[model samples]
Target: MRIAALLGASGATGQKLLPLLLDDPRYDKIITLGRRATGLRHRKLEDRVVDFENLAAGFDGLKVDDCYCTFGTTIKIAGSEAAMTRIDHDFVLAFAKAALAAGATRFAYLSAANADSRSPVFYARLKGRTEEALKTLDFADLGIYRPGMIVAERTDRRWAESLLFPALPLLDKVMIGGLAKFRSIPVETLAAAIAAFSMQRGCGTRIHHWQDMVTA
Candidate 1:
């Protein structure tokens, strides 16, 4: 039996993940922390409202075996680079630290494809930086999932997704070898893979791309 703490339960992928975790027999309890409630109830689920800016205070005393984070935001929604960084980078690392202190030995983070710390792109760089920062926490196992186009119905749909999704099938055919990581994937598949990998004892850090997630 395991105790799992998850952040970002209200997001697309996280919403999918919450039910899976609740249904999985491996987890004895599931704790979800966020700025607001998930409005979800399960026998094994415990939702807590936490201060994203000061996670440690709100997250204290909640011990778990594993912690998974799916928290993310775009620069447009966040309104500024600093604001995006606060949500995507600062808050994520803060949660990892809090979870670690609370006796969590495993941590899982939802990053994105092309997340190179030295990348010229701001979003990729931020994700890469967060991945790097997570490694320093000394979790027994760290799973970083870098998914490409997450295929999901979104309430706040992006124009780019609308433009790109139709072309995704053709792009997937041509995108082979090194570029396969960027291929589009269903959010349900992605969520299942993230849940499976995080629940296991893998040891050290493992980075999952499209092939990694689908194949696993």
Candidate 2:
């Protein structure tokens, strides 16, 4: 049996991912530390609400074998680039730091498809910076899932995303080889893929995309 820690268990993808780990016989325990409770119960789950600004007390003396990070937000919803980075980048790195200190060896992070640290796009750069920061930690395995637009019924859905979601299937058909990574993926599939990646133990950093997740 193994122990796992999950951050952002309240989010769309994370919410779906939580049950997979809880039901899987391999993971004897699933610890979730987040700003809000996931509101779901499982025999294997231990959910805790904590302040992201101060995680030291929350993770004190905790030990987890693997950690999953699926928390993220948008610039529009955050109201500014700084706020967005605060949640997506700063908070993410903070969790990685706390998890590492708590003896986590494997870390799985959910990132954007075209994240580039040097990109002019704020969202992509934030994701890229977070990914880079996570690598500096001492995790033996770092799984960075760079999934494209996630398709799901979100309560806080963006106008643009709602308009574009209907066309994603048509767009996906034409997104052949190089563009395959950018194809929109369903939230359920993304969650399953992340869970699959978390189940594997290995060394070095690995990045996954649409094809990889679908096949996982």
Candidate 3:
């Protein structure tokens, strides 16, 4: 089988996933696209440095079996709500359009746990809108993963999550249902699940919640 693309090949989860994709025999060719070059040197790896918002032209010649999107940003680093939405929602939608035009077989997205298009929170609202847009694409296999508080060692995560980690133990005790026991999952675990689920055939549009990942 031939593997097509990795959209966020430089981010936290994407970094861990790169090695696994390189080592896996299922994919003969791996194409990657991001704002900056990944500087990843491999026989099967083709890295493209371009703006995700304007990927339609850049994606003209690309074809892949699956498009894995682990791309995300925070409001702090993004400087403003508009910028964050641009990267997190607009950019992702652009990539999805390109992928569909290229006739990709599947689209895998990394969305947060509390995503809701009608949510009061702006971040979650954007994620929800993006998820809704992806559903409209009608890909044969559409997988959305909602991971909560991914714990990656030596990651470049924003300071907010870092500050919240210390309180997790106490929070877990008092929190209930999905909010309670909101255990921080490791990045490797999330990436492994993405790889495993992406390989399976015949799965339609499905959303995997936080507990599903913990149990899977």
**Model 1 C-alpha lDDT per residue in residues 1-216, reported as the tens digit of each score:** 688999999999999999988988889999999888889878898888977878887566766888889989888789998999999999999999988888999998999998989999999999999999998888989999999999999988788999999999999999999999999999999999988965569657999999989986
lDDT of model 2 at position 136: 86
Writing each residue's lDDT as its tens digit, candidate 2 over 15-125 gives 899998887787899999887777887788888889888975668767888899998888888999889888998888888888888888899999989988998987888
Which residue pairs in model 1 clash with each other?
A: none
Clash count per candidate: 0, 0, 1
Rank order by TM-score, top first? Answer: 1, 2, 3
Those runs of model 2 whose alpha carbons end farther than 4 Å from true positions after fitting are: none
lDDT of 3 by residue, 87-193 (tens): 99888988888888887878889998888999999988999999998998868998899987888765566687789878866765666686733567789988877
Error of 2 at 32 (Å): 0.9
The TM-score between candidate 1 and the true structure equals: 0.97
Q: How far out, in Å, is residue 207 in model 2?
A: 0.2
lDDT of each: 0.89, 0.88, 0.81
What TM-score do all the candidates reach, one by one? 0.97, 0.96, 0.90
lDDT preference between candidates 1 and 2, better one: 1
TM-score winner between 2 and 3, please give it: 2
Scored by lDDT, the top model is 1
